[model samples]
Target: MTIAGAQIVHEKLEAAVKLLEVHNVDTWLILTREGYDPSLPFVIDIETQDTTAILINKSGSHQAIVSKEDYETFKQTEVFSDVITYDTYMDEVFLKVFHILNPKKLALNISLYDHLYDGLSLGLYHWLERLIGSNKLREIEVTSEPILKQLRCVKSKAEIEVVKKAISHTTDIFEEVFGKMEIGMTEKEIGQLFVDRMKMRGVTNGLGKPYDLPLVCIVRCGLAHRNPGDHIVVPGDIVIIDFSLRCKGYVSDIARTCYFLKEGEFEPPEDVQKAFDAVVDAITQSIEALRPGKKGYEVDAVGRACIEAHGYPTIKHSVGHQVGRATHDGGTILGPRKTPPRPQVEGLIQSGEIYAIEPTIIQDCGLPCILVEENVLVTDEGPEVLSKRQLDLITTPYKGVK
Candidate 1:
């Protein structure tokens, strides 16, 4: 790891230690083989070939046991107090360390609600049970979901910096592509502009393959999150680009809507403009409600009400989700409250968390859908809009055919 990367890992390690103390977790254990655990990258940037155990104690002691081949890799980091290397099996060494730590509450990566914390595979869980014996495993085992939630949801200073850079790069590409867009360009061609820009900057799509990175919808026949096709943009066509890019292991997700004005027209049709206005209002209201100490559903309701009040159908998806290491970083979800409120929606919004607020407005008639997503940082005062807000619909004038 470079100096900066190593510094980030150290910062995360320090934060993880504090989270363990806050949650009353005596010891936290992560078991991985062939890079299975999602939390591995955040904690340590190394991938292990064989079964590896990462142990962090509330007492500020950290240790790791890896295969002989991977010993030097872990040791070189100088983060772990003790890096033990074994020849054949790690069960014996892991048990030895378990006995030494003798933690009263041992937290493991297991959760039903959050996939990011559900990194411990069934096979690995069984292996741990067998190795430590079922009775003792049950006596000390606890889910690491609470600690993982804060660890992932709350961003460090370095993490925020990386995400900011990612968002800046993503928005810049959007501006460049939208500025050069024309009436005759196919959805695929427009999507290519983003790809070209990403390549030039040495960045990548946040979620999937580059070709499938941005969802380029012509808005009439296209669906959300679907790949761009050969559908050509014509006069009066509304285009929605949902794009995200990965930077330095972090991600940024933003969406923009554009209109191809017909000849002599300066603005989009009445229906499109109305839908866009409603979307902007929803986003604005949602951000106002995105403050610390608020529940996810509370913030979501603000945006949902704004859209419905404007005579639009209820949004299909949640108003927003926490964005971080992943696109949907798997923490609090700004969604509607249910009979028994879902754990994710009931999660309280805290400072230091970044959210992508995207509320969709599908028009009543044949008008195209309006989706405006913005990234924000929750603070004590309110949310600070990280991305440039799309207050008005972007317009590309139609140049008559040659």
Candidate 2:
């Protein structure tokens, strides 16, 4: 049987067709070198070491033109309908496709506003201009931002299942790592434990910001604890483990908070519990208010309001952001209600989009940061929480002194 990703890729291609037609784009070009393009994961399945050009049109046409060395690898993905290989003369092959299709409104993966659609490099831009000449280059629309962003925001069933698998591993790792935590263990040790556990499970990287720098994912664990250091986890300290893993091309962003107990303590301190409750309430409010046609800022207001209602200061970052392919999958951001004029923040929330609703409280009742992040899918009915919500602060029973 073909794996679920095959079906998901097919769905994505179909969606791309509709999006092209809606936007009146004749051709959408994604040109990248060394897999720097963010949309590559959504469109092309395999990794490419050399330059690649994926051309998509409204008529259900998908073609991938890549270096001869990478041709077989790209074809193996089976996502594209046509795969063309080129050796020394890449510009010739690219121009041939350009002349054949002769798209009036060619859309390239270049955007000044959102990084999600701005994967085109300066060198690639110059190469493309030289390939097509200046006059024909005028037809280039640079309108792939909304089209590509929309395609990624909506999660197909197959895509959702992949993310769920990642989440399962993440939650399981949390249990195992937290179980071994002792009072004398330094924060760095805890972070390293999570990293080692992920590597043991064959997970290579974790996403701090979705499209994170190469090795930064391993140490982006400060969401629960401060920057990993030699500081020993004290009895009163509440540690938050905010981490994500990339599994099978799909990424999982998850976080859980635990309290270090004093001797004979059965549960978390009252103040911490209250703050945790407030964070939960904020997430609940945001999830309840999420639906198709709702604006990003509006949904953010629901969570921000709830946090402030509990006498906590307003959150510094966005209430939530879409997650898929990258950690901070840009496009629709659940930001402040009184948002400044920004493209994604002011955009409408559509059904089929996946959002990470994470409301954070800084220095809450003497705690450094109290935060809870949950993944949710926007459905026609309402928001569907993907990751299991952290209802109560995980209580770490006192392990005796070292």
Candidate 3:
């Protein structure tokens, strides 16, 4: 947990190296100078000290080119084979390092296909090109998407523990917030409540807030705030709250509607409940179908077919996403639009991977209702629900009961 959490990241790097060896990736390089400008944070999860450039090879080799100021910091880990220090720029440092390694393919953090490929900024890419002198750095492929997607997508035992804690805390917060919500409650108030609850929860082992911010706290009342937006909640309304939270750098997301109703004012809307049920069933069946060696699109199709068969429109978003440090960890989309399947969602849902199969729907009615949103993870055999399996409708009575 040290800001120089570099040592810990070194462990992750070592783990990545082992994985790269298994997968036959000759080398994986993380090139960055000012830490701040890199796609990842200065105290990034990958670890290592200083604003250093890293290279992990299939030959079980590791190297670090650090800033002179951070030479001691890099030494603290003693993990890399070459811990070279530089002052002005890593341009010459990179060339020297590459000449020594002479790798057939040099992978860089640039991906046009995957969202994460853009982690290496265009400007930085230009800088790297200039430093390496273009052609010298032949086979400089934008392999960031595949490398990072796999390294991060496939969860570790330690990572899963963090995610479990995140799921536990977020669900507990939802339970408490469910009681506080009322007809006249504003969306911002509820969102702030989630923030406050997280603070009260405090950090684990004094580790601090675990980066647990409800990045998205949705409060959709009536039909105004149904979709993700800045709409306010009002009295005598049908409110739907769809939110995702991150804890300990692990994320958990759930979207359940809160209808503000008097005890006997109106019967539970059958269509809305039905829509919610459909999503639940779809999620259940899809998760059942989830297993290693099965393509992601197949699982996505299960959920898509469930709601679509019920005569409701399929959710626009993907059925699920690979979950990790960021909310949308790279791997596969349960609901893939591309034909022949994209590489990300093509492979099986790996055993160590965790995911959020959040399929949402809106029943046609005077008052809009976002059907269901819950969190689940891929497992050795199948999918597992992370939250306290929400089955029935959450009836928020006059007192705002959960």
Query: Which of the numbered candidates is closest to the native, going by highest lDDT?
Result: 1
Q: Stretches of candidate 1 above 4 Å error?
A: none
Off by over 4 Å in 3: 2-11, 36-51, 139-142, 203-236, 263-267, 339-347, 364-368, 399-402
Q: Per-residue lDDT for 15-76 in model 1, tens only?
A: 98998889888999999888789998767876778889999889888999899899888998
Tens digits of per-residue lDDT, candidate 2, 1-402, equal 146666777778888899999998998999999899888767766678899899988878788889989978777777677899898768888888878888889888888787878889989988888777877787565568888888888887788888888877877877898688878777768777778777788774555643322221112234433455666777777777677788877777777777888988888778788989999999899999888999999988899889999998889889999887777877889997554587678889988788888888876235545767888888898778888889988877887767
Cα deviation in Å at residue 77, candidate 1?
1.8
Instruction: State candidate 3's TM-score.
Output: 0.83
lDDT of 2 at 96: 89
- What TM-score do all the candidates reach, one by one? 0.97, 0.90, 0.83
Rank by TM-score, descending? 1, 2, 3
- The true-versus-predicted C-alpha distance at residue 320 of model 3, in Å, is 1.3
Kindly give the number of clashing pairs for every candidate.
0, 2, 5
Candidate 3 lDDT tens digits, 222-309: 4333323345444435556555666655666666665556656564567556766777888788778778777888888888888789
